[model samples]
Target: MNRSSFRSVLYLAAILPFFFSDCKKSSSGPASGSGGNGYYTRFKMNGSSVEYDSQPFAGITLLKSDSLYTCVMVAYKDVNAGLKNAVTIIIYSANPIAANVGYNDPLKSRRSNGIMVPQTTIFWYDSTGTGYLTAGEFADNTGNTGIAGVIANAKLTITEMTSASVKGTFSGTVYRSDLARSAAITDGEFYLKRSQ
Candidate 1:
């Protein structure tokens, strides 16, 4: 990730939730979308699920249900210790139903009313020529609560296959409840590259 890109991630870690949530309407105005009578109306997504070399990446997913639009993102690093390979999907719409969509929702974890899981996975790279990182499973919860964790199998898979010119580096600060943990993604990226 370039310095600008890292900055962008840090920015998203702060305000992207608006883009991910029902905070704004899909059209016609700024933050004017409505989640009318329904069981949908979710909150936010993390990655864009873009396809480059026949693969998905660390991205935010946009999911719209009976009445809402939600976003989901999955990313993690820390490969060697096998301790930070976790995925957190957060969902929160301005609607009551959307309130159910979140990672690690104590009330909704085992219930079916909160998360909408389809078929998807995402991969992200710490930097160009640094190796690739992947996340699995899906975790959901509301922002008010703690984000849950997905049981993922992560690894660093980059070895003399691509040109460094096209690959990139990653940087960004995280917004954790505890500011001390603000370097979440950075820690992940560094670990991914070092392990391989």
Candidate 2:
């Protein structure tokens, strides 16, 4: 597999187990507008609103390795039938993240504490079985060109972080595997608990 494909597989491998665990939905009512009711993940993709209610399976996770800290946040929903949609964001930093901060340039790596931290990445898996990546890279398929994809702009900010939950917002443009199409995600907001 190509590097991008391999990375995609690795990411899926890391998170699938958490998703499969038993989960329960929150008892709160549905969300309204951008903020209300209870914890929620909502965004507009291509001007279409998509929201995922609070569930134990969708939340944030923190991992540590030597000096690198990785924070992963996931928002997932089973829209209908067997169709599933999900959005995941992965952030890498040199130190433990404990406050409000913005990851503006997800395509640019930064050096910290003598270590090279990788750029943040976002992934979208639509209910239609299509995938989009902010990095603009994917496995080879029919009519696919082996070129790095372009990301016009992407930003994810951690607006609030507490021992109980993490609140954030994100906006970005992501490209399909073959670069044939792009999706704009806006007005993204998520309030998720820390995954145990």
Candidate 3:
């Protein structure tokens, strides 16, 4: 074959593999997260809400891919409603804001210390409108627990989602416990990125 024809054929051979490879990747679901360093967050129970020494801690984690993410901020309360101190797991979904994305943990309330009181649930929301939480409670405390006015469930409101403009407050009435009485969680922000 002529030199020009030979070179043209060679170029096509090299380009075919790349085109097919890209097509295969794009057809699949969204690319995975960046598995980057997880986010940090904290909170305290208010009024009549006593927190245990362990269990129901809040934090974030990076997934494998390098794009998505997951996180949780649990406030565990240990109360003796009856025979068992019900265990509560309050879950939150990290939403994306200002280019930031939201993520949820794969596991919830996995413990061994045994729940002391009926688990109460709460969901936190922000102005970002990027994510929301699914809340549920375990009220096996017997005697209707007589309504403790506990944090039960809290809604987080913010004027803006940006770090500089992010300003809000956390208010609630915890039934009874060894925790602080009414606290304002105004620190600790979770930062996420694609997992490389």
Give one clash count per candidate, in the order shown: 30, 0, 37
The candidate that achieves the highest TM-score relative to the unseen native structure: 2
lDDT score, candidate 2, position 65: 38
Runs in model 3 deviating more than 4 A are: 1-91, 94-151, 163-165, 175-196
Model 1: residue 158 alpha-carbon error in angstroms: 32
Q: For residues 1-196, write the lDDT of model 2, one tens digit per residue.
A: 2546635654573465355434444334442121243666789999999886535123333443334566677656642212247666666665566556766552333344443333356667777756675642232212133454544456788888877778888887776655677798899888876655
Better of 2 and 3 by lDDT: 2
The C-alpha local distance difference test score for the whole of candidate 2 amounts to 0.58
lDDT of model 3, residue 39: 23
lDDT of 1 at 27: 37
Off by over 4 Å in 2: 1-37, 54-66, 79-83, 106-118, 136-149
Between the candidate structures 1 and 3, which one is better when assessed by TM-score?
3
